[model samples]
Every structure is written in C-alpha cells, then in structure tokens.
Target: MISHSSTAHPMPNSVVNLYVYDQSIAGVAKMPLDDFATAFGVPKESINLNSPELRRYFLNHIQIITEAKPWQTHIESVRVINSNDPIVREYQELLLNFICTPVKRTSTRDFTFKYDAIIHQVITHKIMVNVVQDWQGGILGSQVQVGEIALNIPKGQYFPLVVKLQNGSWWKGFGSMVSLGMYHIAEGADHLLFLLVLLLPCMLVPNGQNWGAFASASFGIKHMVKLVTAFTLGHSITLFVGAFQWIRLPQQWVEVWIALSIMISSIHAYRPLFAKKEGWIALGFGFVHGMAFASILMDIRLSAGALAWSILGFNLGIECMQILLLTVVLPLILWLSKRSEYILFRKVVSAISFLIACFWMLERIFFFKQL
Candidate 1:
C-alpha cells in the first residue's frame, strides 16, 4: 500500500478554532472549535461538506480570516477546511456533543447547585467578564447606553449586558462618568503635570496683604479655567465632527502640537512669557489640547447621538475633576505663599517642569523614538 504517513499524522486533542467578531465592528477572536459549536447551536457532523449552516459558518470564518490576514488571500477555502484531518475532526465532534447535549429539568436542589457552580465559574474564573469589559470599552468608552441604543444588539456581542438591564439607572451612568474622568487624568500625565506647573507660580505670592500674590492667584485661576474650558469646547466640537465622519484632522500633528503646547506652558512658568495676554495664549494652546482630546473620541466609533453624549460626559468629567483639584489645592497654595521657602519651591518646581518640557519638545520635534 502507498504510504499515507506523508499526508497524515496523529491528531492533537483538539482541532477547532472559534473566532468571535466584535458586534459593533467585525473583528475576530480565535476560540476552541467545541466552544464555537456550542455558542452557535451547530453540530460538528453538520460542519462537513453538505450542510448549508456549515457553509454559512465557513463563509463567516473566511470573511474574518480575510480581514485579519490580508496576506493570506491566495489560500483556498476548501483547503482550509480540509486541513483538520480525520482524528482532529473526531476529537472536535466528541467535545462539541458532550458540551451541547441539553440536560433534562431536575430538582430544585440540583438547579441551585448548578446555578452556584455557574456563578463560581463566571465570577471566580473571570475570563468571560474581563473579555466583555474590554469589548464594551472598545465600543462605548465606559458610557452606559439606554433605550433604543440598548435594543440594537448583535449576535456574539461581548459588551456588559448590565447597561441594558432593567435595574441599570442614571446612577450607574454617573459612576461611569466619574471613573472615566479619573482614568483620563491618570492616563494623561503630561496634561496633569502642565497644570501642576501652572499652579507652582501662585505658590510664591504672599497670602493676605501681598497685592502681587493676590493678583497672580486671581489671574492663574481665571487663566486655568478659561484654558480648560476652551480646550473642552474645542475637543467636544471636533470629537462629534470626527466621530460622525464630518472632518478628520491629522493625528500625528495633533499629538506633536499637544506636546509642544505643554512645553510652551512649562517655559512660560519659568518666566512670564505670556504675562499680559495669558488668556489669548491659553486659547491658542487650548486648541491643540482639544485636538488631543478628540483623538480619544475618534478611537471610539459610536452612533452619532451616543458619540455626542460621550463627548459631553467626558468633558464634564474633566472639568469636574479639574475643579475638585483646584478646591483642594488653592487654600494650601494661598497659605504656602506667605512662607519663607515659597520662592525656592517655585524655582525648583519650575526648573523640573522646564526640563520635562524640553525632553518632550525634543522627543516630538526630532522623533527621538525612545523616551
């Protein structure tokens, strides 16, 4: 007999790969074949040559594979299907049949035990919950969707279903907004640092009677508020526009300009660079910050109305956090100004800010590649 050894080898324990696509956008996930069959209510034997459902499944698989692996365009579909040999196919079929066989209704005790087991698997194991959270953030940017937006669900969707639950309310939405605000502040270290440096100068003025101190504090507060507000307004406008496909700004230029703006502000802290026209300077630089903020929204492709709400919520969150920081820091800053160490502290903080700014400027301008 002709040797078949050249064409076939002993199969591994499993052969199927299940790819889950993002409901909002067609992305792919590679999963076990047995799991895929259970998820779709398809039989492994039916996945062979003749079944229409099998053919449909194969087509979906091919579509995702084509999108993800563009270079593999020349690969034949029949060849791809047949690549899993007899032993592999048998193993996959066995696993799928075992998992998908429906159980008969049992006693309440059995049901409770099973329910507890499922909860343990879901909550303690946590793989399912984490995957779902990541998928939701990819779509919603942590916003809680309600009403008709929640009804348009797709098959194999991975987002948290809680947002659509009857118990889900505005409190959840507010909490989500708060979480996103803190996340943005933590993630945008450069922005936070620039704001801190801006506050450093105010720390040097005398607390009560010093007219220069009073003037500087008043100016700083007004300038910071105007700058932040302008940034919020600019970004909100662009975010909606970009998300809805109205306009597209060059992202690379946006990032570079954002870094440059921070650098410029840091330099200004060293000496009064925009002393008289601080508001104008803030407005000009705030435009760049707006672009930076817009970049985040563009990454989240939501429906037009959803995008608008997200932009509003995100900006409101940012403003609230900024206000909170000011409330806590302003009193301490006013008190510190009257101290003997105030001038030294300002110089040291300003020097550090200037150094960081120079580093960022060089990194952005020359494409330093490594920070």
Candidate 2:
C-alpha cells in the first residue's frame, strides 16, 4: 500500500508511505531472530538495510509526475514492522518512506503516480494508494482512496494513477477543530463529572457549615455564571500557553491530578468545604484540566497561523458545550434545591463521584508507574 500525506508547513513536496509484504520481496524474509533477514538462494543472516542498491531499486520503480516534468524522489528510510491481522498474523512488512519534490515550485495535489516496487516481479502482488492526511483538504486523521496499482494481466503492464484531491480552505480546518473540541468534552466523563459536582450546591446558601435554604433564582444564576466564567478563564490561559509548548507537564501526572480534582470537588459539594468560595476552587482545578486539553493541540502539530485559529475555535466549542449542558441541567437542580430531600440526593451523587474519581486516580498512578 502507498499513502500520500502532508503535515504542518508542508513544502512544495509530497510524502509517501509504501508498505510491502515480506514474502513479496524475494531474498528478504521475516525470521525469528531478525526483523529483516536476507536469503541469497538459501537461508542466510541479515544484510545492510541501508544499501545504495536497495534505495536505487525503489527510486527507479516509483514516479510522481506533474504536468510533463517528473519530480525528484528520495528513499528516506525502510523499516520492518510486524502485522497483527488474523490473515497475516505474526508476518512482517517493509515500510518504505519516500519524499518527492517537484523540479519547480508547484501544487502537489494533482499528480500521476506510477509505482511497481515488488509487483514488478511478483505478478500476483497488488498495491493500494490512499490519501491519509491533507491538512488543507480537511482530511486530517482519515484515509481516502486515490487508486490502486497492479499489472493488467492481458496487457502485461501497470496503469499509472492520476490523483486529484478536493480543494480546502481555512474555515474548513477551523470548523473541524471546533467539532473536535465539542466531541472531546461531550465524550470526556471526567471533565463533565468535575463540572457537575462543583455546580451541585450553587443554588443553596451556606448556613455556617452546611448548605442552607435555596437562594433566589437571580442570585443562584449569577453565582453559577461567575463560577463558570472563572473556570473558563482559568483554562483558556493555560490552553493557549501549553498549546505553544510554553508550559507542559507529564501527561500521566496531569491525568492523575484531574481525577484528584473531581474527588476534591465531590467532597466540597457534599459538605460545602469551600462554601461561597467555590468560584476560586473552580479556577484552580480548571488550570489543571487545561493542561490535559493542551495535549490534544500538541498532537495536532499545526502551523502558527492555523494553530491560532484552532485554539480559538476549539475553546469556543468547549464553552458552547458547557453552556448547553448547564442550560439543560440548571433548572432541574434549582427546583431540587427547594425540596427537603435534595440534601440526600446531593450526598448520593457526591459519593458516587468520589468513588469513580478514586478508581481513575489509582488507574492513572498504575499507568505512570509502568512507564
């Protein structure tokens, strides 16, 4: 299989990934003691994987053309990787990475790809071509089929594939990031749990140590708004700094802290540990949660201009989702606060949240120790 992709600040060149089964390449085999072993008409040991002849062979067989001119191609590296598929279980494949550059600066979206590789000698072999990532095309983290390359049995020749990818714009990329952010929060249980636990007692007044009667609707709404804004502000600061790599912490520790934050909030919800100062506590925990959010942006690896847009879109999505959730749940919580049994209901929810957080904390610690 051959994959065409691009990343941040993509140059006027193309990156390709070529996957070939070991059995298709003669003399090269997967052995028990070696990742890639060579057999010259008989069983033998390893050979130089970085041989010039091997590189030349691949470069000669593959071609990427735009207009009437051919691009300069280089074999970056060849790696042996094991397969876990049921059909080819325990088998190994060779990954040949290639970088092709045009003689003159031009767009790489449209090109004619001609690859033979092992299929030149192995008649039954086939090669699949796909576009795995085109950042500008809004094709991040996905695979789209370009075409396949195989011998035309009757004609005894291989057909060249012409690939034309869809055009993309900045809005498309930004919109995708927004959707990703909304999905992340909607799917993240820990983030939702912490927010919900913190908001549990916002509608009630503090009576020295315990939660008192339900406050006026206006007061409750105002307090909730202040608390949510503080949390949002705290995270937004770290999300920006951490995305640019200005501040970073070990992911394991961040995860452990996130779980711990939920546990602490659960305690505060049940007994009003922080009482009227919940907004301050929310701000502190929000900073920790922002670090976790930063890991996502770091993995995206976008360029400066695109990264800025993404950060804005992503944070907007998170806030929108949080507002939506609060809108749906706020009325119910307010009504329950006036009931005589709301204290019991609140304690039950807090206990469950605390136990769930304890489990997550222990799991994250175990993962950290293993690393």
User: lDDT scores for all predictions?
Assistant: 0.45, 0.72
The candidate that wins on TM-score is 2
Error of 2 at 77 (Å): 8.8
lDDT of 2 by residue, 187-303 (tens): 989999999998898998988778888998999889889889999988888889888889989889989999999999999888878887888888988898888888887766566
Residue 68 miss distance in model 1 (angstroms):
25
RMSD of each: 14.8, 8.3
TM-score for predicted model 1 compared with the true structure: 0.53
Query: After superposing candidate 1, which stretches have Cα over 4 Å from the reference?
Result: 1-23, 28-178, 202-231, 234-245, 362-371
Quote the RMSD, in angstroms, for model 1.
14.8
